[model samples]
Target: WVINIVRFYKVYCDVEPKRQALSKANADLAVAQDKLVNIKAKIAHLNENLVKLTAKFETATSDKLKCQQAAEATASTISLANRLVGGLVSENVRWAEAVRDFKQQKSALCGDVLLITAFVSYLGYFTKKYRQDL
Candidate 1:
């Protein structure tokens, strides 16, 4: 009984670290997913704004007053759109980096879990064999 208890304790100890690692990997994946969603939303908003600006530019008349006003609107929108594009590019880079890191961590944690499972199976086999021998 003492031997079985020791074996169980060892298994529990081995599993505990893997459980913690899995939790951390899950957390990191969630954070990366959230960042990706936010970045996509930002890109969508920028595209919508650009479309609105394009429509305004198309409808403007050539009269000096209308032309100047439209030109100013166009310029401002273009500038804002360009900045948004630049920001999106940077955000995409960040998202990509985060996804890569999260993937690596997830892969490593999966490997650890697999290894622990195999170790536990082997330990169980050994414990049973020992009991039979006794």
Candidate 2:
């Protein structure tokens, strides 16, 4: 009976360690399963955000292309306007100089006409001897 008791005690000691190891393995497996569930949920959320961002990026790229085209057209128009205005400015300066010359010539012509008219009228009325005496 004592030998039988010793044998039973030895078997109990070995079985106890195996049971504890199995319990620990089961707990670790449960924790790992929970973490896996959380990771899958996070991946799903990230994929949705990526889809939305991709759509927004495509819209922004199209808008950028349109804006660049508009800018180029505006720049060309501004260049044309500058060239036209430059030519007109030079023409305006030349026109102003011509007008000033015309004004001066008109004033000189008026004085010349008055002098000729006076000489003709006085010379015709007086004789050669009276003109020489005066």
Winning candidate number (lDDT): 2
What TM-score number comes out for model 1? 0.39
Q: Write the per-residue lDDT of candidate 1 for residues 1-134, one digit (tens) a residue.
A: 99999999999999999999999999999999999999999999999999998778766644557889999999999999999999899899999999999988996898899998987776775767684674
Any residue pairs clashing in model 2, and if so which?
none
> Can you give the lDDT of residue 35 in candidate 1?
100
Residues 6-90, candidate 2, lDDT per residue (tens digit)?
9989998989899899999899999999999999999999999999999999999999999999999999999999999999999
- Report how far off residue 76 is in candidate 2 (Å): 2.0
lDDT computed for candidate 1: 0.90
Global fold similarity of model 2 (TM-score): 0.54
Which residue pairs show collisions in model 1?
A: none
Off by over 4 Å in 1: 60-134
In candidate 2, where is summed lDDT lowest over 10 consecutive residues? 125-134
Q: What's the CA error at residue 94 for candidate 2, in Å?
A: 8.5
